[model samples]
Target: MAKLSPKNLHCELVVTVDEKINPHIMRDRNTGQIYADDDYLYRLKLRSEKRVIECDGLRYLDHSLTVDEEGNQELVLRGSCPSGERTEVEVVHRFSIPVRGRYIEERITIVNCGKDRYYLEDMRFGFRRGLCPAYEPGQLADDISRFRLVAVPYRKVGISQDKGSPSPGARPSVKRQEYTMEDMIEGKFSNVDWRNDETVVGQDLVDRYRLRSEGWAWTDGRCGLLIVKYNDEMIEYSLVERNGYSRRECLVFGGAGFALYREPRPASVLEPQTKVSFGPTRYIFFDGGWKKAFYLFRDFMAEKGHGLPDGYNPPVNWNVLYDIGWYHSDREKLFKHYNLEALHREARKARDLGCELLYLDPGWEVCEGTTLWDEERLGRVEDLVRTLKEEFGLELGYRTIGRVYRDEFPNEWYIQRSKEKGQYIRPIGSDGKPIGFWEPCTECREWWEEKLRRILGITGEGVKFMMFDEFDWRGPCFNPSHGHPVPSTPEGHVRAVYRLIEEVRRRCPEVLV
Candidate 1:
């Protein structure tokens, strides 16, 4: 006898059966009469019955063995309902793609049985990466992170147009009509794709791989197709809603959802229609080796009959800082008054309380200065960095709001740009209208690049990290210096900031770059 290896297991099945039925009855037990209509009949006796056949006694007609030729076992299960209207369900499952040197897969299926029309409201499939849960909420604070589910769709309702608009030859020309999902899909929706992945940490080293496609579904009277993938020991599900290959828009429906967890006991009896819910599903991808998982899962899904959108890039892990203090005044104040010395002393008291970085909030600079170092209060910036590094074994970081002090650096390019754009320094009034005495310039790329370069040079001596403050406050650039008056959308603005960070990384690659 040979020991069963974890990698070579698979399950597949196909079920066919009779229709299911459900019965609804109204009875008068005391009168010994079943009433079809109690008010209308003097004395009525009626009996009605209906039959329902749900998923029952459907065993795997195929092999349930754990090992197969494809490095994993495949399971295909099929069944049918015997109600007046017959319906069939086909379930295909692939199990045991290796992750952290283990193989696993779990699949489930539900078929419509009741007389009432059934809707495929939502579908969810989930699995554990290793012996442990995939990820916790706290792990998401860093740049490179792993998540359980990568992408899910948000449901959007379509708006219809009115039919009373004037014709082109009428007195006034009508406005161009707003497009529909069909129109957009035909015109713009093309070359889309779905990619997903997961990573598992091991005792000695991390192991990862691309998840292969596990199963897929095509339902009657439904406008879209749903596909599921069990890859890299994680689940990847994609719903592509389109009209043939002609045109389609990927609509992501936003609402509460759930992921099925492993039941404590498979044989435990349960009631039907149990309510379940899950947390907010964010579309995020893994970093490093985990990206391969996404590619693999995407390929598997395409193979399972889901159409890949043209040129769709699966979300990848990118460095993003959601500066909480930028929007919240209280958070800003808390960070400002944070006791660094006390924190350092307390950290030394505990064996596990040490941080490599000490983030300083805004207001470190003298409210009246233009230089990087606030000479009056913070003293020399270099001295502070040295003290933090030497005493607490931590690197110091500071925030910059990109404001220039006219009295100090009187020849700043931003001031000139502001004047050219006809922008005035509005005084911070009680009404929050005219806010304070600093020149505001359109965020020209050249201006920001030059500013970052100067700041980097000044802080290059000792400072290790830099936090760009008030990033959200800097609105879209509309001046001639910006090279274009077109407003920068949120996505464009985020990309620009990322580019700036990349430049900073390039400049300071070794100093914890």
Candidate 2:
């Protein structure tokens, strides 16, 4: 067949695998690892086989018209099997146009001479944007473009509900569990595998995102009837699910093609065969515009297909934070020269730019005889919070440093109680060890709870958020009387601090707990 280019195309081919051969035995030529046994084995195998073409009829083209192997015009298939029961399959694929745009098509086929039946599982076909990087160590950082799987079969397992339990005559009711693939395919599946690297990994990083695994399963099954409309352009892949009583389906897409083979347990069974047809379909292509593509995909699916499944809520959008202010005094230097008025102005600017919360760092209270709000230097906390909400439409939050308030106020009660309980007091230097100062009464959970309630009541009045900080630190205390048994490990201390946070959340759910 003549090599296909972006300019001229339309082709088809047929591939068949017998029933007795194990499809899982096929190893990837590039990695030398079995490609058919991985999580999405069949799909990977179809991607690797690059020989078949899809068109109106099969016709061999001039060899000179084809692209050189190194020029990206070659369709090639390389395979390996360790058990030596089946013939290795090879198919060479070549593309004419160097760049893929609006309209495109691909074709592929497999020849099986093995003695076993091969079950056809899935097929993937599409014109991938950007260069596909060779599967080598540490190559992800250099690859700019990615191979995205445009379509695939959906595999899913469903659970059934149970009937009345513990009833003697209730017929031992049971429900059925089922598994199946959806016939439809759409969306972009990337070829950047993150399972290989850890440091520059793609999975957890927020900015680099991909279609989730669960989303792929929902659109499996609607074979030939599916159409991928890119903007106004549409590309069609043909599908043939049941070729005959003895053969399975052949799924073809884009300018690329795919064939499936089911592996057999023993080497003696006859291979199964099937023929499938797709296309006469159209592709609506857009130029260098991804936003348009996304909108078109969503609209086409909504109008002609099903939308996202039930219970599906898009991931929450969160403000990406660099470094939160008000946590460390060092960061306060960013606005140190600014007084209350200047700080309020800067905060208002941040709010206008979509900042959801304003964080206040520690040093809010004057550590004196009456640990009162430091009105002289920091201005009125309540007034600032009110201005943030009414004037700037922003939320307020503060850092909580678990230290004794040395001034006169409701906090003074906590100081007095700490003394009465003999929890701990500042000790004069003896050795070089850290000294224990004011400590909460660990034995009296009520004391902690009451103190927290009082503190929350005062702070939560005007604040919309609270950043509890400095709760994890070492302190000397083996006082059995006050109930704290001196944390034995760092993990224990961490857990204790987390427990306090949980308590705060349980008490105030509306406060962004």
The TM-score obtained by model 2 is: 0.30
Per-residue lDDT tens digits for candidate 2, residues 359-466, read 655445444111245566667777877877788777676556554433222322222222234433343344544333343432235545564765565465566565
Judge candidate 1 at residue 94 and give its lDDT.
27
Q: lDDT values of the candidates? A: 0.33, 0.34
lDDT of 1 by residue, 365-434 (tens): 4442233454444456677667766775766665565444343332333333232455344334445564
The best candidate in terms of TM-score:
1
Worst 10 residues of 2 by lDDT: 259-268
Cα miss at 137, model 2 (Å)? 28
